[model samples]
Target: MSSSSLEYKLIKENNSTQGISIEGWKIVTKKLPILNSQEIEKVQKEILVPLPEMFFGNNSLSVSNDDYGVLFEFSPIDALKLVDSTKEGGEKVKVAYSEEWTLKSSKNHEHIKDVIKPYDWTYSTLYSGTLKIASKGQKFEKTTERIDIEKLKIPEPILFYDEIMLFEDELADNGTAVLSAKVRVMESGFFILQRFFLRVDDVLFKMNETRVYHEFGTKSLLKEYSSREEHYFKIKAQIPVYKGDDISQLTNPDWVSSKLTNSEELILENLNLLGGNYSKI
Candidate 1:
C-alpha cells in the first residue's frame, strides 16, 4: 500500500469511532444512537428548523491534515442550518401531506411548537462541509478546477470505507427524507459525499450531493456540489418494468439519482492546504 502513498493503519476506539490514519492525513468517524428527548431539546434551540423525527445528534465524520492545519467536518445540525429557513424564496418543496402532518404534530408534539418556524420541509442544503483552518494564510478560494471523474474511475484498492445516517423522517408516512455521509480512502487520496434524499410519494424525488476529493500529498482539494431532481411521474416511469414491483427502489438514492437530471452544479471551492503556497496547476 505504501507504493500508492497510502501507508495507513485502521483506528478504532470504544466501538463507536473508527477510521484510518495515513501519512499526513487523519480521517475519523463517529456514530451514535438517536438523540434522547433532552438532547433533541437542546438542538431545537440551536437550529431554526423543526428537528427531524430521527435525529442522530452526535453523529459526524471529519478529515484533518495536521501539517496543513485544515479540518473539514460534516454533521446533522450544521447541515440543516443551511436549509431555506426564510421560506421567502418560494423554492422550498412542501410534502404532499404537509397539512396532515401539521395537524398531528400540533396535537402530539407541543414542545416542538416552541422552536418550529417556517422552513423548507424537504431539508435541502448546499453545505459541502465545515472547514476550519488552524494555520495562518490558508483558505478556500473561488476556482474553475473540477474533480476528474475519469481519474476516480481507475481501479484502485480501497483502504477504508464507512457510511453513516445522520437523520431521517417519514413525512407522516407520506414520503421519506434522509441525510447521510459516506467516505472512502483509496491509494491516491479519498472522497467524501454528504447527501440529502427526498421523496414525496406522488410529488417528486430530489437529491443534493456534496462531493469532496483529495489526492494524497496534494496541496489542494476539490469540492463539488450537485443537485438533481425529477417530478414523481417522470422518474417513476423510468424505473425498470421488471423491477418496478420492488417499490423500495423509488426511495433508493442511487436509483433516483440515475433517473433525475442535474439541475445545477458548482465547484464550491479549491482549498489550498499549503498556506496559499501551492503552484498553480
Candidate 2:
C-alpha cells in the first residue's frame, strides 16, 4: 500500500508542553494472519468496550433518583506460542498461535498487599492520555486539552484482551496469526519521543550493565530524539488442530527492533537537554 494511505495524528501532553503532528508511513506485513470475519468483529467489540458498565439508581424517590454508571471490566486470557517450522523449503521461522483465554483476578486481597507492600516506600505516578484515530482524508484537529487523571475515574479494574494464542488446531493447515496491530502515530513524528519516554524509563535498569545508560546519555542528545524501538510483545493466537500443536509446545518468540528513522528528534533532544523542565513525579 502507498505510504500516503496510512496517516495518523498524535497528541502528547505532559508537565512540559503539548504538541500534535501528522505523518505518513507504511505498515509492511510479515507473516500476516488470516482472521475470519467473526474474529475481526470480536476484537473490535472487545477493544471498543474495554470495560463493562454497571448502573445504580433509586426506584422510588423523585428528587434523589439519580442514575450513576460504573465500569466493571476483567482482563481477558490470551497466550501466544511460537513453534519452530518443520517445513523443508521455508526459513527457520516460528509460527504464532493465538487463542482466547481467561485471567482470574486474585481473589485474595492479601495478594494485593503482598505485591504492593514491597513497594510501600515507592509510589506510582500514572501517566495516561488518549490517542484518537482519524478517518482517512479527515483533517487533524485537537479536541480535548488536558484530562484530569483524578476526575477521569475508572470504577473497576482495567482489563486488556490477550494478544497471544496457543493450541494445536490453531495453526493447522498453514494458518497465520497476527503479530502486532497497526499503531497510529503522530504526523510530525513526535510520537516516537512519547513512546521512548514511556518505555525507556520502565526498562532502563535492565540495560544498565550493558552500558546503555552511559552510552545513551553521552551520545549526541539530539541524535536520539526521534528514535523508535520495535518491541516484540507476545499475544494469544489460535491453536492448530494437530494434537501435538498445543500452546505448551511453543517457545518464546524472537524480538523485533525498528527505529522511527523518518521522525524528527530535535524536539526530543531539546527537551532532554533542557534540565528541570520535565519532572518524573
Candidate 3:
C-alpha cells in the first residue's frame, strides 16, 4: 500500500455587537497518507496499546489561560465540515484531522480572564505529507514550558503577523488568500501609527482587495477616558493572481514598502501626525 498527501485550512468565527466577526487567521495542516502496511500496524498497535492511553483519550484536549483569557477549543470534525461545504461539488473523502483551542476576550471586556470566550474550532484540508513505516517503533519526546504573562513586562501596541508562508502549499499559484494583522492595545492613550508590511514571499501574487481595521485607539479615546484597556484589530485582503500567472512576477518585492510610502504621504499632506510611532515593525 502507498500513501498520498493532503492539505487543510483552519478558520474560526465569532459574534460581536457590530455583528459576526472573524478572529485569528489561517493555519495549514500536512497529512500523511494511509497505507495498507500502516493500517495493519495500526491494528496491531491498538491490540498492544504501546502508546500512552492517558494522553490518547479525551484528556488529549485541554485548555489554559493567561492574563489574556482561557484557551478556546477546536474540533477536527467541524473543520472537515467547513471544507466540505466550501468545496466545488462537495467531494467526500477521509481527511487528515486535528483539534485546536483559542482564548479570546469578549467585545466589552478588557482582559481575557475577565470577559473570556472559549471556542472549540476546526479547519479543513490544508496540506498533506508522505507516510513511512519502521520495523522498530519510533521513540517519542516532548517538552513543556510555563510562563506568567502578567509577570513579563512588554510594550503597548504589540504587533504580530500570522506567518502565512509556513503553509505555502495551501495557497494556489493564482489563488487569493487573506492575511490578518492583530494589534493589542494596552493602557489606553495616544499611540502613533507605525510602519507594517504583509511580509509575504515575492512569489505570492499581488493582493486584489485589501481591508484595514479602523483605528480604534483614536475612536475609543473619543468614547471614554478609561485606562487599562485592550483592543484586538484585524485586517483581511484578497490576493490578486489568476491561474497560470507567471510565478516569477510574484517573487521578491518589499511588500510593506508601498503601504509605508502611502502613510508618509498621508501624514505630509495632512500636516498632522495624528497616529503614533511611524517606526517599522
Give the alpha-carbon lDDT of every model: 0.78, 0.19, 0.21
How should the candidates be ordered by lDDT, best one leading? 1, 3, 2
The deviation in Å at residue 116 for candidate 1 is 12
Expressed as tens digits, the lDDT of each residue in 76-146 for candidate 2 is: 21211111112321221111111110111133333322222211111111111111222221221322222
Cα deviation in Å at residue 74, candidate 3? 8.4
Cα error, candidate 2, residue 198 (Å): 12
What local lDDT does model 2 show for residue 103?
14
Candidate 1, residues 1-281, lDDT tens digits: the string is: 34555468888987889999986789999999999999988999989888888998899999998777778889888888887777542224434445544554566566433323466666667777788654545667878888888998899988889999888988666578899999999988999988899886666787888889899878887888888777776888887789847777787788888788756665567887766554331
- List candidate 1 stretches off by more than 4 Å: 1-5, 87-91, 94-117, 276-281
TM-score of 2: 0.16
Candidate 2: regions farther than 4 A off: 1-103, 107-113, 118-234, 238-267, 270-281
* TM of each candidate vs. truth: 0.85, 0.16, 0.19
Per-prediction CA RMSD (Å): 5.3, 22.8, 23.8
Q: Give lDDT tens digits, candidate 3, residues 1-281.
A: 11212121222222210111112111121122222455445543433212111111111111111211222222222212322233322221111110100222122124323211121111112211111211122211121221223422445533221211111111212122222112222232211211111122221122211111223222111111101100111111222346344443223223322322222111011111122233221
Best candidate according to lDDT: 1
